[model samples]
Target chain A: MEQNIIVSVDVVLFTLSEGQLKIVLLRRERDPYAGQLALPGGYIHADKDRDSLASAERVLLNKTGLVSPYLEQLYTFSGGVRDPRGWSLSVAYYALVHESLLVPDAELRFELWPVAAVPDLPFDHNRIVDHAAKRLRDKSTYTSLPCHLLPELFTLTELQQTYEHILGVALDKSVFRRKLPELDFLEAVPDAIRQGKHRPAQLYRLRPDRRLTIFDKTV
Target chain B: MEQNIIVSVDVVLFTLSEGQLKIVLLRRERDPYAGQLALPGGYIHADKDRDSLASAERVLLNKTGLVSPYLEQLYTFSGGVRDPRGWSLSVAYYALVHESLLVPDAELRFELWPVAAVPDLPFDHNRIVDHAAKRLRDKSTYTSLPCHLLPELFTLTELQQTYEHILGVALDKSVFRRKLPELDFLEAVPDAIRQGKHRPAQLYRLRPDRRLTIFDKTV
Candidate 1:
């Protein structure tokens, strides 16, 4: 009575490059939609993978060549018509990394598309990208999720701009800084300062072991 | 080179009974774990099921004989050793309903286990239950998730009590009522009032299509 469903993992690797949110899409080297750029995905190897998470990590590593520091299980998209082969289930995950980590090489074979205007893609990949983008935007309002899109050491102004960019709003600097003490997700690098056009600003990084810090109020 | 992995759905249907959070479990009738009280779960028929959500709703309604309004995709649990029958995947979901809906019948073979002290269940069910309970508790602090455990019409005191019960803390009546205007999820039901020993409290129902409302700050 086995139904023989095809299982796979897809990663929506998101990065903020040039002040715009973008996701990585790799050209499928094999059929269903070969030679077309799609979300980095592949079939789950039940024998080699310890579980679905391991499968997702492996697929991301193989397709993107960068191990993301903040990978989360987004959602599971499944249906019969989503694939031509058979009934398929994509255990989708979303990852956040700085753009500097995605150094393009000769054989990387990947392209980045901004989340606002993702082009038509094969299967239900567009829908999966939309869902992942919405989750990131919604969570960034009250969590320290946007910090993942920034480099390790960043100034307070850069962090606030990251939040504002993801939220699509301008926040009052005083109000944003007021909530930072209680949020308590970032720690200043001792004596580290960035010299910009203005006076030097302290550089802060996410506190150790505080990856996804949720705040009581919106930033 | 098919893995022949088993795909299934498991539901952690929780309800508030006598101020306790409990989940429903059913006795398996077939082999592999016959007569063992486990989560209400079954294999997904790729031919008959539309999608994973449809499969989850079908399994819950068929096994429990009651439809839940607050069913949501909890998480996907998959591995090789969770089940004795080789590699498996279980797309888990969680549902919240009032205890009055669980009407016991002679033919229905099910039991309720309090989440606080769940016993040794079969096939990683205990772990699933723990995950669902944690999600509910954490979301209750910022979202109006616990309100689903109340009847259609309830008093503000009842709503606050429900939150307190799920959060495992005592909330001040004055502070909770102060946040009600900002929460704005409930509407007074047409001047309806409930008579009690001290005074009549106004009856309220959730505002139209306002399920799972998020608050700006903690109550």
Candidate 2:
């Protein structure tokens, strides 16, 4: 028996801006949900390469005019009734891009909102964003993923702020400092860096040899 | 605007048995392609809850004739051409259950195979399995998830075995043991227990305060 087939890709782009976490969203200019804020996405081609990662890159570049960055497959959305159109399946991906790196050209119309102020998204995209947010929060607790969203050689305070923003909790300064040394994944740089009106804080970069492992360590 | 609507859910049931990591899979009884080993799943009903987690539980319980154990949303599969019948999306969930607890009845014919022995699964299941396996491996490195598949108060050897099985690696016993003390998640019971012909091994249990966090501690 023949079956109708539909496939699409959506992106949840994350960035750190003005000491807060933000997400990239767009307003659709065409039909089928025009003017609604939605995660940028599109239909998949029949002859497209089977690599979902590559497909995500293609769609994101086409829609937002952004190129290669740290992208990972987030999840899939396939519910019979999720779409008003025919059978549609979406392969959703989450990307970490520096805010300064985002260059919105003429092709795309979008805005970046601090995660806390994000409005209602289109087509279950809110759920997708929530999932990515949870992953980001949980991952930061154990992995070096937060580093991707930060500037190179950031201060301990800056790093901690990113965690606090994602986790939504005030962390103990001393306790957080004690935990950093255990994370052999980070390497201290030669010079301390100053952020306006504050004492220069120690700068550190992600250790190259340190691969992210989801192993628990005593705090 | 009339799009064919199709939806499905696939389960990745994981268990630890005889010091090996195994997955539960079903042999297709009837289909456009029958007599093949595949994940147990089916279409979602419109009348059902919109929560994917709830829908996954309902579909998994129906297919396996088993109650819910520990289930986590893995990923969503939506590649337009993944389903030949039409555009279909499959929400996949990965679950961990004690092998002894699963009593698959006659209706749902399935076999438990080591992750290594699993054949090329149908559809994008191979990809799904790959993703779930990676998550399991990564999570096992630092979380209390492995303990969920083991009996209460298991020996360090058994715990190590579970790690080896999931990670597909022979970790140094001494190093592995040393690392345990660093992980506040495991607590040793006051009483030591002997199993088989070996000397009494320290029995350990999961610490209630130390829950599994889905983050990679880059050490």
Candidate 3:
């Protein structure tokens, strides 16, 4: 029997913009929900791409002129009812990028919608977004995953604020500050400080080798 | 482009035998590694299977007579060089089963090999086994995943030994017993005890409606 599964990759690119979680959505350029807002996705290139990850990278780069530093395979969704053409399977990926990377000069303009208030998307995309957001929230509580939402160098206050926004709970300032050093995933940047109206605060960055770190307990 | 990607599903069915982690492997019946030991896998029936999980369940049932209750979707592996027939992608799944469910009489007899000493397998099956074992071990520390490896009724000592066997560490007996109630995933069976020559010890099972639970700290 011949199999004709429509295999594709969808990316749920998340960023913290103005103290809110946002995801990038693009307008489809072809039929089957054409000109509608959906996640940046495309069919896997069998000849050009090496694998699904390469296909995801190519789709993100082509649809939005931004490259994500942290990308992970979220989950796969499939069924015949998901696609109007035929049976389809999507290997969804969730990526975290700094808001500063989304410049306003891309050839094809994409919209950044708040993850909390996203509209109805085509082809089971809303479900994908919800799954990705839940994953981001769940991992942010126990791992250093939320650090990707901030810029390269940031103050501890800004980092805590980012965590609070994602976790939706205010962590005790003293407890949070005390646990940072024990967690040991951050290091103060030499001679780096943020110039604000108040007294300057020291800036910190993730350790050189700690791309992603896990904690034995919730942070 | 005509996408000729061969999408398939492979299952890493894990069980505990002689206090060692083992996975089920089947001998391929057709060409392209015929008669070689490999993970139970088959092509996705585009017309018959609902999704990747359905395909995995079907493949596991056809290859092995037993059905696994705790099957989870693991990572996906894909590339051109994996399968000799053509470019292929495999959505891998890991399943946990109690040893009692596996009967000796089956149409196509399967072999159980310890995860640590598994010999060379066909079609990236060795890599799949390693990945499944790592996932199971990692989750065993903070989640109620190891409970699936034991029979319906088990003593606390049996459960703790299962954990120690999978984690490859000796946990303090008092500390292990204290954390079980706080985790609240297991409940003492109503007036049940293990028949033994010494004193009859209480038997426990996973709490009703608590299939899988995560803990803030390691159990």
Candidate 4:
């Protein structure tokens, strides 16, 4: 049996900015990879932490001073020699947050790098980020766009644009609108409208009853 | 930082028998939860094991003489005190195999239990099994039905029955058959046929080019 095996949680926090997907990375504070950029994460507290997800949440709050609106357990990477310190395993997580949440925070100790243009990251973080990005794109095709990435209220066109940006594809406006019926989580904001170039577009926000999961039914 | 944390890999291996979905379990051989039924697992061997998945595959081959046809990473379990040995984490995996692979080995130490009627499993094994069962059913609805669970060659009726058993629902025969064209994984076995009571049903096998993944396009 392997001795001295430590468990940690690494998070691939994702958001959209300038019409592109981005991930948040923090500079490592300790040796073994100090000064190198890596995903925001820390060791799980055996006595204090309730679970791996909680540990990841703690890492997020400590590094960025913001809370993720949507987070899920991604793959666990314990393949190669990721840690310079003996054998260790990291339970990775992927989270979604609105770009606006972090854009105004000048005190954040992390940098948001475009998903495609990410430089070399320490450990297996680059591989972890790649997996999470693929997961987000795959889910976006079937599930409703992550509302947390947008403002409190948005128009249908704006929602469609978000999906297009994440999926890296162009969707027909009419076809995309037709699928809105299946997304029962969205609720029309009464009397609220977004003035567009041609006319005022109706505004909608995710219903309070609906959780982050936009659709449960199979696509 | 939490010290003395151990990481292990637990596998929920699934197969079909007697038209029912079943999972394999082995009796524990150690203390803390000795003599109780539990998922086959062991501590990660950092010295020899290449990765967590490799540890899972090693455990499968060591405990059960047969190798799995399909295996996927499921959720990781790290809740309350699941182990008396202190804080530990299990990187769980779910595998699929044909029942015929194990039915011939009467000396195997594992027992097959229906997914719905799983008895009390020690150390969060039950929760892990529950999550794997739900994952199998969910994937069965949209994915390729895990053809590895069936013989190399099979009839459409036989394949549909496998789907029905895993999903616990009767699929419309015509509708189910009509969807096969989209699967593209199943290739007709040339000149092979299964003699039925009324007529002979054509046999089909997975195409060499197509891997296990059946569906790539959005539903």
* Residue A217 C-alpha lDDT in model 4: 15
- Model 2, A102-151: lDDT tens digits are 87777676788888888987677887788788878877897788877777
Over 4 Å off in model 4, which ranges?
A: A103-107, A196-198, A213-219, B103-107, B213-219
Candidate 4: DockQ? 0.50
Residue-wise C-alpha lDDT for candidate 4, range B38-129, written one tens digit per residue: 89899888888877878888999989876766778887888548887777789999988988887536556898999989999888898889
Q: What TM-score fits each model?
A: 0.93, 0.70, 0.95, 0.93
* Candidate 3 or 1, higher DockQ: 1
Tell me the TM-score of model 4.
Answer: 0.93
Stretches off by above 4 angstroms in model 2 are A1-9, A16-20, A28-38, A41-63, A76-91, A98-101, A104-107, A119-127, A137-219, B80-83, B188-196, B200-202, B208-219
Q: For candidate 1, what is the recovered fraction of reference interface contacts?
A: 0.56
TM-score of 2: 0.70
DockQ of each: 0.45, 0.18, 0.44, 0.50
- For model 1 chain A, where is the 10-residue window of minimal lDDT? A210-219
Candidate order by TM-score, decreasing, is: 3, 1, 4, 2
Q: Report how far off residue B64 is in candidate 3 (Å).
A: 1.3
Total colliding residue pairs, candidate 2: 19
DockQ of 2: 0.18
What is candidate 4's CAPRI-style docking category based on DockQ? medium
The better-scoring model by TM-score among 3 and 4 is 3
